[model samples]
Target: MNAAEPGQPADHVVLRRAGATDARPAADVWLRSFAAALPTVVSPRSADEVRGYFRDVVVPFRETWVADAGYRDGIVGVMVLADDELSQLYLAPGWRGRGLGDRFVGLAKERSPQGLTLWTFQVNKPAHRFYERHGFVAVEYTDGSGNEEREPDVRYVWRP
Candidate 1:
């Protein structure tokens, strides 16, 4: 069962640094969350490619965080911090709307107290609102050219 479900407060979701062993699970969480949250935006990477990325790059280089949903649920959320940029934050579909996102953002702030920056597709209205609620302001907008997905994206920055 999801930690976000009834009687299982999302507070039970434990956030911790991701290890190499977590690469596959974290990549799974990212894939599921991405498919659920951003249906309009197509991902250019295949599942194996994503897993390879997490294994070779994210888990090794990035400050990656994963939310462990108890011993059974494994990783239900994933977040990546690349310097001052919150490069990624994705929760399992069932885990959305929980306070976990807020906690993740809080941790991100603590990790980068001066500021944090992130980018989300223009079609992701929920993400836009979520970031805004956490003091992230839209600083730039780009056409569908720079990114691999070729989808219009907006950059948001949070200043402490």
Candidate 2:
């Protein structure tokens, strides 16, 4: 069950640990969210590049979660809880701003009491604001690679 606060819509958003069966859909959502959010950074990723990313990076991250809108069919969002860090959290563009992210974070925190930490693209102002609203503080920043073509990333930490 979701560990959302009372009256939070996330309380209704079903959250569960992702298994092998969820790989494809979870990857799909991850790709979609990344593509949608990437244009704000350096450049949009090609389909091949996104697929390769899923194959190389995302799939190997075994700890994943999928959030659904109280349905058994479609997925609304996905999150990766890796150790004490929140490695990835992505909601479908259409399903954003409805407290799904908060619910996902809440569930992750409930399961792992060390609280949550994440890295967000520095250019993603909205995400920065959302994380700040959720009590995350920027603790550090790093270049998007050894190269300077891409935007930097800000590391955020949330202490419960």
Candidate 3:
């Protein structure tokens, strides 16, 4: 996949299969994006908890697609696509609202034309809207937190 040179204005980004070397940047983008979005969605956790969450939940997810703008300053964004699920998609805070997420989700749909599904905290209205704008519809709800009792999450699905 070819991404426009960094700092250059361009259209949608290209998606590429992630490799072992992509893990760290993927982790970084995930951490930064989560941190940026956390306070509005959930109670903020300590730094260690965040790091541990990344290690435990994000790192081991094998299927991933990465987006780059042809610069190595850091990973601009990442999308974790496993099975018919889009587990995660995050761009640096600066990169948010630039249509990258739309592009990423579009690419994932192309790769999995049967469609894809993902879970998101019900309180994340912005995310819900974003997904909805991309053709996803809330199909179910369940405990957002893994704990037996907590606020519920809404499951969203997209069908091509």
Pairs with backbone N, CA or C atoms under 3 Å apart (clashes), candidate 1: none
* Top model number, lDDT: 1
lDDT of 3 at 117: 96
The local distance difference test score of each candidate is: 0.92, 0.73, 0.73
Cα lDDT of model 2 by residue, 1-160, tens digit: 2323334454466787765556666767777777787665554566667556555666565577888665433666888877888888997766677788888777777877867888888888899998898888999988877334467888999998
Model 2 residue 59 lDDT? 54
Error of 1 at 82 (Å): 0.6
Q: Candidate 1: where is the Cα deviation over 4 Å?
A: 1-7
Residue-by-residue lDDT tens digits, candidate 1, 13-44? 79999998999999998999999988888899
Which TM-score value belongs to model 3? 0.77
* Better TM-score candidate (1, 3): 1
TM-score of 2: 0.77
Task: Tell me how far the alpha carbon of residue 146 in candidate 3 is from the true structure, in angstroms, after superposition.
Answer: 3.6
**For each candidate, what TM-score against the reference?**
0.95, 0.77, 0.77
Cα RMSDs of all predictions? 1.5, 5.2, 4.4
